[model samples]
Target: MEKKSIQNTLLMGFIEDIKLRYKTGNIVEKFIFINIGVFIASLLFKVIFGLYKTNGDFIFNWFALEHNFSTLITKPWSIISYGFLHAGFIHILFNMIALYYIGNLFIQYFTQKQLVQFYVLGTFFGGLLFMLSNSYFPLFEGTRPHLVGASAGISAIFIGLTTYMPNYQLQIRFIGFVKLWHLAAIWIGLDVIGLVGSNAGGHFSHLGGALFGFLYVNQAANTKLNIWDKLSGIFTSRKKPLHTVYKSSKKTAPKSKNTDLTQQQIDGILDKISKSGYDSLTKSEKEFLFKQGKK
Candidate 1:
């Protein structure tokens, strides 16, 4: 009996470890969990409601029309929540597969915070565009359109990763290594085609998210203010002081020949450069000036 108890405990521990791995692996795993959990919940809802259709309107039916509308207006959380809700098993399966692959690529280089920022921002903007298109466009007029799935967010991730690492290469099973930009071009081209054709709203949403992703990576290359970092700073600012304290002692120690120069000293060197050409300095001084400029 003791042996059996030990075996059971070990089994429980293994299961817990597996759970933690999936929970904490990356943004991809979290996305998969959301999709799978929603799918299971959707199945349960179907069982209870006796509804056979997987139409987007099911959100309205299962939840309520008012609740759905409220989600659009008062609570914008639905932008993300609706991504998890799917019309069928295949709908989520493809999305999760794409997300897993693209999300893995993103997380390899970017922080988890960046992944969250891109995903949430992409989903929000995508939903906004979809709603706008459905509301105003003649193609979708007179019909209450409901969208569910992670394609828009996934598309954003794919576009963002490609933009950040345009020269990066990937190898497919049958195809040889292909440049990342090539893949991004093809994906965006398909969305553009879809924008003017059928499923216009869905395609438009994908474009909105994709555009954000592209702009995000481009701006990130030049600045430190990624959407996620800005969002975090807002919340973190509540408890933090307006300015950080840098403790400096008043007493000055003797400077050694190898000691690093102060900013003022560096500025003086630059000022001398502005007056006299590079040839005016000694070899060691020239080397020191070059090193400072590099910094």
Candidate 2:
């Protein structure tokens, strides 16, 4: 009975923890959780199937993006599914790190829906490029393996931000300060050179994602409208903020129902956050910012 009670308590605590993160955490956190969750699920399936003496390659076959167009007809979901699938630790580690840094930067200037669109569409285009190239390109006529990993999605994000803010600079260890455009150039250059290497499909997919990023930035600049927003309402569920009503005293009614900070004040705080990042905020400021978000 005691063990059962302890287990129940732990489960409840875990549930609450997830709820809290969902309430307060940003899109980047959610994306990371999803990717990690999928990776862990894959590991568990591998272990379980191993114990049962069954092959677990079915999971990869179903989820990971394949090169052949004929195979994709049966598993169309692989276009986006492959973005969340990673074959190994190093593959996921580098991808997740790039996603974290680039995603955080992306949120400063764009909405969550835009970020989701970039990731989803990036993977789709990457998969499409891989399939077309494998089918048509004389270079990869004989060999075309399955594609898996978050590299294409991560590439889209990093290149998107770099294109949007080309002049931006970041301080790197042993490298001093480097411009965003320079970093992007290096990344694309490496991928271009890597096309002749073992993972040519992967490199091509990365280029496909980078192409989307560059084009997105150019189109957004010219149109002053987010291409992703056109289809956002169709795919995304919107959560409206709740309004709290309060009773006024008989003696004097409040000038404004909201006792919270003004729009100007909030804008100032946001600017500060954008310029210095969230770590620069004081304890009280952080609390206020959090409360404002909840409101």
Candidate 3:
């Protein structure tokens, strides 16, 4: 009875620990868990189908992105669904590794919500590009390749971070320190070269994802967006700022104190950035800055 009780306690503890970790984990960790869970579920389904002497790939076929337009129309969710699936152990392993590092770095400078936007949108664009390649390119005439993997999403996070901080240095193993843009260049360069290779569709998807990341970060940082301003100015040519000449000292007194406090906090954060660097700021500090920037 004692031995059985001990075993049961240990098993419950292990299960509880996993549950706790998942609950406390950030969005990146949650994504990793989801991917691993999907991979294992796929394996289990494959084994079960094999035991019955039947094809197991039908399950994957339903979820994986089909290159054919007619087939894709039937399973539209596969564009995002395929990002959570993987072809093999090595595929998921590398993708999860890249996501973990790049995603963690990404959250430091951007919000978790923005990360999700980049990842999902990247996957969407990548899948579209993959389908387009199959339809237009003669090389894929005889092939019916299905897209599955988190590489497109990971590529977006990687390239997005690189774009946001091109000069950020990372100490690589045996490669010393390398600039973020340098690594991004190599990443895109390989994909570009792979266009003629067997995995040309995969490369196309990667480039599509990288392109989104680059364009998004560039547009965000483009302060002198004169064309956009000009277009908006044309539309709002007659609009003028509303002014309030009336004063309410009682209402304004408390607001001024709050505004001063917020400004002091912002000043403190700016000073910290100057002393250490943007990366040195804590998560809360970074979030505060991010919120302020939106305003």
Q: Write the residue-wise lDDT of candidate 3 on 67-135 in tens digits.
A: 988988799899999999999999899999999999987776556766787788789889989999999
Task: Give the true-structure RMSD of model 2.
Answer: 9.2
lDDT of 2 by residue, 1-295 (tens): 9999999999999989987886788888888888888998998889898899998766787899888988888999998899898998898888888888888877766677678878887887788888887887788877858899888887887787776557666779998768778889999999999888889999989988888776665445322235555433322344221111111112244545344334445656655654455566788877776666665
Off by over 4 Å in 3: 1-9, 221-295
Error of 3 at 129 (Å): 0.3
**lDDT tens per residue, model 1, 1-295:** 9999999999999989868988777667977886787788777766766655545344534432111345566655677776667777787788888888889877655566677777878876777788777766677756666667787788778888776557666767799778778988998899888876767777877887888787666545223335755543432323321110111122266766544455456545544533342345678776765565454
Q: Cα deviation in Å at residue 108, candidate 1?
A: 1.3
TM-score of 3: 0.76
Model 2 regions lying over 4 Å from their true place: 1-8, 221-224, 228-295
lDDT of model 3, residue 32: 93
Higher-TM-score candidate of 2 and 3: 3
Total colliding residue pairs, candidate 1: 0
